[model samples]
Target: MNSEVILTCAVTGAGDTVGKNPNVPVTPKQIADDCIAAAKAGASVAHIHVRDPATGGVSHDPAHFREVMDRVRDSGVDIVMNITAGGGGDWIPDPADPTRGGPGTDIQTPAERHHPVGELLPELCTLDCGSLNFGDMVYVNPADWLREHARLVQAAGVKPELECFDLGHVWFARQLQQEGLIDADPLYQLCLGIPWGAEADTETMLAMRNKLPASAQWAAFGIGRQQMPMVAQSVLLGGHARVGLEDNLYLRKGVLASNAQLVEHAASLIENLGARVMTPARTRDHLELRGAQTGGEA
Candidate 1:
């Protein structure tokens, strides 16, 4: 088991959850505040995604990201910023015409998706290792695209949190490392419980975690009701943990939760499991992240 766990809270994911949960932060200011709240509640990192403030829909706007980053930095909080590069992959194919993109299709070049991360230059950012049938939509992160994305992220001097949704993704991650695309020490995020991808059960988490490079530092999270359970499972398996409104909304059955509540709950679970939660300083040291804020390798 991991003696010290780095807790990350993915605040305000690009999902249709604002209408369902009033506590979901929509605007840039709200999102930044949520990050601060997560930090105060014992989160070492904040995995962020911007939204169209007016519609609460997923937005790839660099302006929104800048505002959120500025607000968080200006707040005097010391949480590690982990921006999202997982946007522009939603592919809801047209029902009638298979060749045409449907109304919900939002695909973009690797450069377009990496624009915000390259511009903002956060310490850590998510680089989805591979594509999978995410629910009804095919979240396309093709191998070539992934290679290009990895190169771009490396050029920008950012550490990627390899989001592995399946065992194949873990395999592909190792290939990227073997090809010298990824940095010396890789970081993995075992994304679990998403539809048509890796399941939330213990067996799947173990299978994916076992596939990581021995030198890799990793964390795992499960969506919806399995969020807390995965926190325990991840720590027990010697990996870090993530929790927030991005993955799960409820604190308990029929009870809505804020991002801070989720972090606090996860922190409690980690402590109860005889593992101490790592602070922002310790997490940066552990991950060897780079950025102006961390003062390592800018």
Candidate 2:
């Protein structure tokens, strides 16, 4: 088992959770605060996704991203910034015209999707390995699109967190590595429990983790109730852990959770298991991260 672990907190994802949980951050300041709080609570990295402040919905505006980045950087937090480059891939079929995209269909070219990551240049950014049936919609990241996106991320000198939602995604991610698109020691995040994606279980996590490159740095997270269980399982399986409001809304049954609480709980779990939490500096070194300031190392 891995004795030292890096815990990442995905502060606010671009999901329909604002109404469900009032504490879910929407504005740039709130998102930045949550990132700082999670770092103070022992999260080595913060995975970020900005929402439209007026509507509190998913957004791809570089201005919004810049505001959030500025706040986080100015806050003097030592945590690594991991911006979400996996946006703009949602596709919903039109009820009237089934052949084309629908009202909720938000797709973009590789350059458009990579705009924020390229402009702000976060230390780490996520690249969803492949597409999957996400509830009624489909998250459409095709092979060619992924190839171009990976190349773009590589040229930006940022580490792409290969987000694998299923077994096929793992296979595809390995293909990207073999083609040398992933420059640094590839970082992987086995995303579980999304609709129609990989199931949240020990066997599934192990299968996905085992398929990773031997030199790759990997972590796994489960959505909803399986979040904490997967953290323990990941660590026991010699991988890192991820937690925060992005993946789970509740700290326990019927309890809404903040990003910091989730990070605190994950840190406690790592310590209780006879392992120490890796700091942001250590994570940067381990993952070979490129950007972000070291204002106040946690």
| Per-residue C-alpha lDDT of model 2 across residues 112-178, encoded as one tens digit per residue | 9999999999989999999999989999999999999999999998889999999999999999999
> TM-score of the candidate numbered 2?
0.96
lDDT score, candidate 2, position 1: 78
- What TM-score does each of the candidates earn? 0.97, 0.96
For each candidate, C-alpha RMSD in Å? 2.3, 2.1
> 176 in model 1: Cα distance from truth in Å?
0.3
For model 1, residues 1-298, the per-residue Cα lDDT tens digits are 9989999999999888999999999999999999999999999999999899889999999999999999999999989999999999999989999788899899989999999999999999999989999998899999999999999999999999999999999999999999999987899999999999999989999999888999999999999999999999999999999999999999999999999999999999899889899889878877876633354321
- As a TM-score, model 1 comes out at 0.97
Candidate that scores best on lDDT: 1
Instruction: List candidate 2 segments past 4 Å from native.
Output: 291-298
